[model samples]
Target: MESFIILIKLLCAHLCSDFILQTNEINNGKRKSGSKGLLFQFIHSITHAGIAYLFVADWCCWLIPSVIFISHFIIDVIKCKCYKDSLSTFLADQFLHIAIIAILWFSLYGDEIKLSYFESFCSVKVWLTIMAYLLMLRPSSIFLNLFLNKWTPTSPNTQSLPNAGQWIGYIERILILTFVLVNSFEGVGFLLAAKSVFRFGELSKAKEIRTTEYVLIGTFASFTIAILTGIAITRLF
Candidate 1:
């Protein structure tokens, strides 16, 4: 349990520093190719190391901060210098950070990890759940988006808030996946009903058949893919 607790703390720190604490100026600076970017990266790495060390609450372990600082610095540098800003790159960056934390937990806790909650990570169900969530979160969204692109209407009435449809699809799939995993088929129905009342009602009332059909197609596709994925994952478990 200690391993799991510490790992969670470390991840919380990472999220706090990497996302919540990071500002637009710092983000833009990190993407630049100069000493200026290096300066920002240095500051960002320091924040990560400091936050992690604080979260771990082991003042005697300077090595924790030292390792975090060096590793984070290198990762950020490589990312900024070698990679473009894309979903894959972002996932890779976060994965490296989390991997570092897992390694750090192992290094500090050693074999004790096996006796504690770290063992859950080694379980097939745990990894399968992770894979399922990953699929529903982004991969499935991209697939649906690309496939639906050809059918997208160019009509002015088809316009909505920027990236609104994408976000809706993400939320809907995630909820559907959760509902399926929990064996709550009716929750999916409630979700679809709610969306129909709130969203489809607007589209249908707009008197734009093309736009309404486009939305319907996307919604049905999203639901089908998410439900299938959830069912597959449950069966695998």
Candidate 2:
């Protein structure tokens, strides 16, 4: 229980420091390959380390916090150099951060770490959950994009940003999958209704029937894919 509490604290610190404490200027600075970027990264790493140290202050060990600072600095630098803001990069970044925290936790509580718990990660249920999530995101996006390509407008609208629809579709499917997995089927209806209400203005204002039909087809296809994926997760797990 103590180990779990410490783990949660470490996670909270990571989230707060990475997303909440880091401002837009810091984030943008870190993207540049210059002194400003390195300085912001250093500040970010120090803040993260400081937060974690506060959580384990009673332990009176500096090694763990030192390791965290160094590792986080390296990871952030590499991420800034190699990746931009996207679903895959975001997942990879968080995965690395969590992996570091897990390593630090095991180091501090080596006796509490069990082989059986690690082995559970290889179980079929875990793989199924991972597959369901992956299907909900990129795979579903690609499938829907292909299916709706025929209806895609030849003259692209300058008003909308590039890949906006794909991003929206990804978020919608993930939400639907969450609702289905939790057995809250009514949430799915609410989601659809909310989307319909939001899009109603655009549909009404658009003079072209093709645009309205296209949106409807895409929306339905996205929802259907998420619903089926959720059902599969429920049945398999």
Candidate 3:
């Protein structure tokens, strides 16, 4: 129970520091390859570490926050230098952050994380869940994007907000995956129906048959990937 409480506090600190505390200006600064960017990242990492330590409040466990701060800074720097605002980068960044937290948690509570606990963490169900989510997010998005790219409209519609389609596709796949995981297959049908109804006007007004077909293909492909991934997870687990 004490370890669980610590885990919750760490997660809260992560959420607060990463999303609540980080501002647009700071984020932008961190993305740039300059002194200012490094400064912003340093500040962010320090704040994150401070919040984490505040939650744990153990002087003997000082190394945990120190590790978190250093690892967080390095990961953020690498992400800033290597990737931009894309699904892969976003997922990778969050994964690294969570992985660091988990590592630190285990380190701080080494006695609690025995062989049995490690086995449970590495069990089939846990792996299946992780795989299902990964498929539903970046991997599925990449596959669907590539599959639809062949039919992409020559003159793309610039009126729509940037990355809106990508985000929508992600959400749709995640929901479908969730429904499948929970054995709520009926919910997937309802979700599809709702989406089609909402897109009815857009599809109807499409000037080109090619455009309409492209949208349909992309939509169905996204759903297919999600459904298959969910099925695989269910069967395997």
Candidate 4:
């Protein structure tokens, strides 16, 4: 019972920091006004500090989820905005998603929580969750854009990215990959899969086959390079 209460409190704190606080500031135009209410906004922003601030003694607690959540939030935001054809608006949404996901993950799994991993290439649960989110993002975005297009003639033409979004998508994908790599090699395969999507999107943007395919191919060829590097570092340092 006590644990449940603590979880609720933490969750509420995150919610307040991520959504309510940001929305209030936006409505009041505080985000735009720099010097006018800088101190006030600063105080409010501290409601949820960065990943470092949350993961205190338990380093692993901070390592995995922070990278996962932040990376996921950023990718979703960028993709959402690209779909809407509004970069600025999508960035704003991304910022909000970062805050919200950060708060939620911190609240729900802040402690030294143990996650189940089988044979350990990647945990079944983690992979499933990732796939679920990926499916949700692509389909949901397509449906919403289609619905809007059908109802509103003014709506931007929907693009399915016979390839992908643009440079921004590639950047987001890389950041996500780096984050995952930092956490575990089990996710290296996932990163390779993500690269396929990135390349497809890039080809769409570049309008032809590009060196990205080579990069993805090279990525596969160099799979154990990180492990070798890690071993060397351990031996030398």
Best by lDDT: 1
Record all residue pairs in model 1 with backbone atoms less than 3 Å apart, i.e. clashing. Answer: none
lDDT of 4 by residue, 130-156 (tens): 322332233233333333333333432
lDDT per residue for candidate 2 within 130-222, as digits (tens), equals: 556666665576567667877898877799888888789989999999999899999999999999999999899987999999999999999
RMSD of 2: 7.9
Instruction: Compute the lDDT of residue 5 as modeled in candidate 2.
Output: 49
TM-score of candidate 3 relative to the true fold: 0.58
lDDT of 1 by residue, 1-237 (tens): 455556666766777678667777998999887899999999999999999899889889898889889999999999999987665787788889889988988888756654544446445455455556656655566567666777876664545787777688889999999999999999999999999889856886866677778888889999999999899978864
Give all TM-scores, in the order shown. 0.61, 0.57, 0.58, 0.25
* C-alpha lDDT score of every prediction, in listed order: 0.80, 0.79, 0.79, 0.42
Per-residue alpha-carbon lDDT of candidate 3 for residues 1-237, written as tens digits (9 for 90 to 100)? 356446656766776677667877888889877798899999999999998899777767888689889999999999889876665676778888988898788777856634443344334365446546655765566556656666888898889998899889989999999999899999999999999999899989988798778888998889988998889878854
Query: Which scores greater on lDDT, model 1 or model 3?
Result: 1
Candidate 4 regions off by >4 Å? Answer: 1-12, 23-26, 49-111, 115-237
* Sliding window of 10 residues with minimal summed lDDT for model 1: 116-125
Clashes of 2: 0
